[model samples]
Target chain A: MSTAVLGAMYEGIKHIFKHTFTMKYPYQKVLLPKGFRGRHLLYMDKCTGCGICAWICPERCISMVPVTDNKEYPQNPEKRFPQYWYARCCFCHFCTEYCPTGALDYTPDYELAEYDRELLLWSPERLSRPPTNIGEYQSVFHGKDGNQGVTFEPVIKQKSK
Target chain B: MTTEPPSPGISISKTAEPSTLDVSVGPQHPGSGHCRILIRVDGDYIVSADPDIGYVHRGCEKIAEYRNYVSNIPHLERPNIADAIHLNWGYVLPIEELQGVVVPPRGKYISTIAAEMNRIMSHLYGLAIMQGVFSGHTTIFMWAFGDRDLFIELAEMLTGARLTYSFLVPGGPRRDLPFGFEDRLSRLLDYFEKRLVEYDRIFFSNPSVIARAKGIGVLKREDAKKLGVVGPVLRASGVKYDVRKVEPYGAYADLEFDIPTFEEGDSYSRYLIRFEEMKQSVRIIRQALEKIPKGPIARKAPLVAPEGEATGRVESSRGEITYLVMGDNSDKPSRVKIMNGSFRNLIALPFLVRNVHVADMPIIYGSLDYWPVEADR
Candidate 1:
């Protein structure tokens, strides 16, 4: 009984020297993988106003509305684009998958918290902009014990379009 | 004080005993999910327990009727987010059967691997919150949760989302194995195997934990079979019945593993069952990864199914989950019924909590790993 108690204590004490598993969020962030289902990145050139994305969305968050901007979209003759209501979106990315023209793609921009409910809605213009807050820390296991930790490395940012 | 004559509407029973007091143990969050157990206690001992469920029910079955076959995956899986793949797979299998869709051997292997990984993740969650925190061992909770994230990271790499991975569709898995996935998985498994030894020593083998759990809530083999408890709960009671062994699905037929059972049938055995099952899950994943054939991951299945009914079952981390789907020659299913483990195992809750100390209630509840949302759904 004494040995068992001591054994448990020993295991607890051994972990005191190892690196902590948690990250300091806001200051330090773990890098998300390539195909992470976060915010949507809409491509203006590829979209043909098919509305398949709006049709396939389970939450009915996507609505194909006419682009109010004067900018001419030659690809979209009807001038229809998907406007997303982020509050209702479950982030299933079925919209991205079902889009016939591959107009929608995933962006690693998960921080979607807003102070006002109205600001949660993202227009086609807002969805077109690239994510700016992608983190650089990648999780890596090191040492003989295979203790998991994160390492910081600079990432080459790619244009969303 | 003068006793009044009893009215015609109100007749008092002479044999009625009022020694027991009824106490409600939360529709509030009881460590795991929102579930209230109405326990009738006679002094320090509980006389009986009645489970008052449906606090988190989102009507998953009814909602499946309105949504098309594909869209139903997300909400159906929401019932138990920890074991999402199994719930998703269970629902999809019936749909595939109805539509006459058979997944390729490679797709089957990938789905099997994902399911096993999900099983490990789910068990780790049970170990952390259900077993660890309930047992009052905070260390195992932290360690298990921390380790679970590693598997979750790999799951995110495979599927796009983290918890609710709508990875498996009707035909097959959504994505094929990613680049360097096998190597990374093998490395994680190696780390996890080593961590298991430390866990056994610290949490499982700890005298305090053993003392608390060893003899408490002993569900004998006969009682277990009679009550129809499923998964680890059943296995712990020396009943060697697993849906994977009895009715093989996914790549379970191809893989070789053992169903670890103990005769003790106590809370400790229940806890140990999950630990043992995690090891088996690791074995299953390794075999699946090794034997994964080179082919296309998924085939294009039709959006609609013919007018018929089909049933499919999978052994989830909690227990056996069976889904019944009826199609009316439309994109949406007419009727979808789910009979999951938590609800089936809920009968054992009130049965075991009886005649035990009030403090022992949490340990018994946790041992069952009863997710109220899944049960209520």
Candidate 2:
């Protein structure tokens, strides 16, 4: 009986010294894959107003509108397009995949927790721009010379302490 | 494969024979899709199994005669929802090759990456179903399905659709990655890797589960060769014949990952192989995400409406999905024939199940991850 009690006590003490596998994720961010799916960015300038993305959407989250960029250039048919609210985005990367000029793109930021719905509504400004010093191909369809508008994805640099 | 079913069999004397039972598993079985098997059993063991297929048959080939080439894309997607990228590429590849559509390097990379993710989910679904059969734990199914949402969400963000995404055209994919896609995908990958450990803890490492699976329904490499079972099952049986390896598609040649194998060919070996495959899939997806070149998701469809017949053979979740499409230069397909792996497995089930006890039926059947609707089609 004494040996059994001592064994239990020893096991408990040993357990206390063991390392924990769980990480405090919310408090401290975990390492992410280099290419993860996140939110959508629609580059209004590069958008051709083609409805293929919307038509191909399985979830029916994407929609097109006649909103004006700065409400200027009313006569330019190409100037008006919809402001995609990515809060409902499925992140299939359809817009980015369908963009003719390589304008639409996917970047590695996936966190979309928000306090308000209004913040989710993004138009041209929300569309991704080319990364610094990356190559860009200028063509109707994203071409071989670094797809029309796709900017180079830089190697992920760890945050400095 | 079973002796061609002996035509006009002569009956044996009933007075001297033991009693045999007739059991019919349906085109409507909850565990299965559209294939029905009528099994002849003597006491606890199955004697002969007759497979009745075409339950979910939508004559894609017949319909293709009226529709145009562009319209057949959705029809192709109906066969396998788990590995949609493979199907997408399968259909696009022939067109790309034939029409002189040299997709940008970025396009090939995206196809390769997306297909690997789809393959992971497909294999996960296969393993989950097997787990459900061996033990009544649907937890892995829920987990696998839940994680599938991540890939679905990823695909949706990329192509604007979850299941029937027409994102991959002949030239290339439809769009580029969404802004901040990497951040979310990175986090998701971490989450997926973490879940993989949990899967190992709960499903793969469970002793009772292992006992139930270890040596059941084994297929010898020789027999598998004769039967022509594809995908991980054949690989699990010590055969290293993968469509990706045999005929390198998209950017598969460029990516680095192992095609996991096991020589046992038992149910346990298959389960383990699939689990390892999930890990490899993560590796492949990570590589694609990291090295995905900045480029156009797709090239323009080189040949606009044309009369052509193209066979899109893809490696689906089940195994090899052969999509035969014919076009008449219109916007739609002239004919489409979707041949799925589940049908092939269903055909060979009786051969595998012969003399096995009734208790082992679910484990044996579920281990194959046969999708009925796909088979019926």
Candidate 3:
């Protein structure tokens, strides 16, 4: 009987020491695994917006919409961007893979936190253009069309994810 | 203000012979689906028990028939979102097998890896539920879910999606292992293995868990056969049957892992068996990841299927989930019937619960781990 109590106490100590794998997620960022698929990145010039991406989307997250009068922005009057709805997205990532042009690709960043239900909705202006890496951007500080460099100091913590 | 109605008289009449008292356990069960068990007791022992089911009657089969084949892939994931990869892969098999689409070696290997990882997550969740309901240790439950987030992170990386990934297409797996996947998976495997020992110390060897479970809910080898329990529960009862072993799918035949068995046939045995099986699954995944020969994850084919009936079954997180698909030369299937292990294994609960106390009911019911959605489908 004494041993039972002693054993229980000892086991309690051992158990506490044994279970040292507690993950602090929200506070300390978790390292995303390699090949962890997140949102879609479409290169508009490469993507024809061919309905293939829309057809292949199992969750129907991908919708090809006309650029005019869309949810995000009416930028670029001539062309339309892919209107993405994260609400219905199952993260199947089929749209990025099935795009006829190698326009679509995936990123490993998945910390997608939003407050408003409307904020969750990404318009074409929000998602249509491809994500050129900061390294690949070739002077992100420079303005487009031969203007002064898009001058900016890393002001806010830019969480591309 | 409206007054509440008075309580009705509740009494347990003791006759010269044995009499029964009814105890019902939930439609709002903490587990995945809504399932209840009604136990009729006599003097601290169960006289009879009825396994109540059908709280989640989504009519997935009926819906499957109405929806197109392409549309059905996402629809099939809802029964248990935890092991969505297994469900997606299972449904894809019949279509892939029927079409005879040539899948590369890597494509098949990737499916096996994804399916096994998803299985580990499911079993982890199940074990936590077992510990929670049987012994009332919530830390393990919270721990299991917390660790599952890591795998979910890993899953999001490979498929470019998180919860319900349509990574498995009719021809092959959708996405290839991303750059540096092998290294990341190896690290994750090491992490999962380290945690397993902690689980053993905190859960398997804990005295309270042993007292609550251990010898309770014994299933004699003969009784297990008669009851037709499947998967780890059946394996623990000394049955050497596993769908993955019997019917080799994907890279299961190529991979090597011993099927753990224990003749004790108690709730404790079931728990240990699953724990051992999880280790073996981890090993198999490591092997699959290491030697996953290079090739495309999917094959290019023309749209839609020609007419024919096909069936595919894969061991789900809960149990074996079978998909019966009928292609009608259109985008939609004629009918899709799903046979989940939880649905089938639950029928034997009434016999198991007899003579057990009302307090033991939750533990015993939870040990069997039957999901209501499996049956409702």
Residue pairs with clashing backbones, model 1: none
- Candidate 1 chain A, poorest ten consecutive residues by summed lDDT: A147-156
Docking class of 2: incorrect
Q: What TM-score does model 3 achieve against the real structure?
A: 0.80
- lDDT (0 to 1) per candidate: 0.88, 0.64, 0.70
Q: Against the hidden reference, what TM-scores do the models get?
A: 0.94, 0.67, 0.80
Q: For residues A99-150, what per-residue lDDT tens digits would candidate 1 score against the true structure?
A: 8888999988999999999999999899999999988766677676475433
Residues B77-187, candidate 2: write the lDDT tens digits.
Answer: 666666667766777766555455688889888777677777776776676665553467666666576566566667666666556666677777766777866766666
* Model 2 RMSD in angstroms: 11.5
Clashes of each: 0, 69, 16
Where does model 2 exceed 4 Å of error? A1-161, B1-18, B302-310, B326-330
Which consecutive 10 residues in model 3 chain B have the weakest lDDT in total?
Answer: B7-16
lDDT of 1: 0.88
- Whose DockQ is greatest here? 1
Candidate 2 global lDDT: 0.64
> What TM-score does structure 1 among the candidates reach?
0.94
Q: Return the lDDT, model 3, position B44.
A: 90
Order of candidates by TM-score, top first? Answer: 1, 3, 2
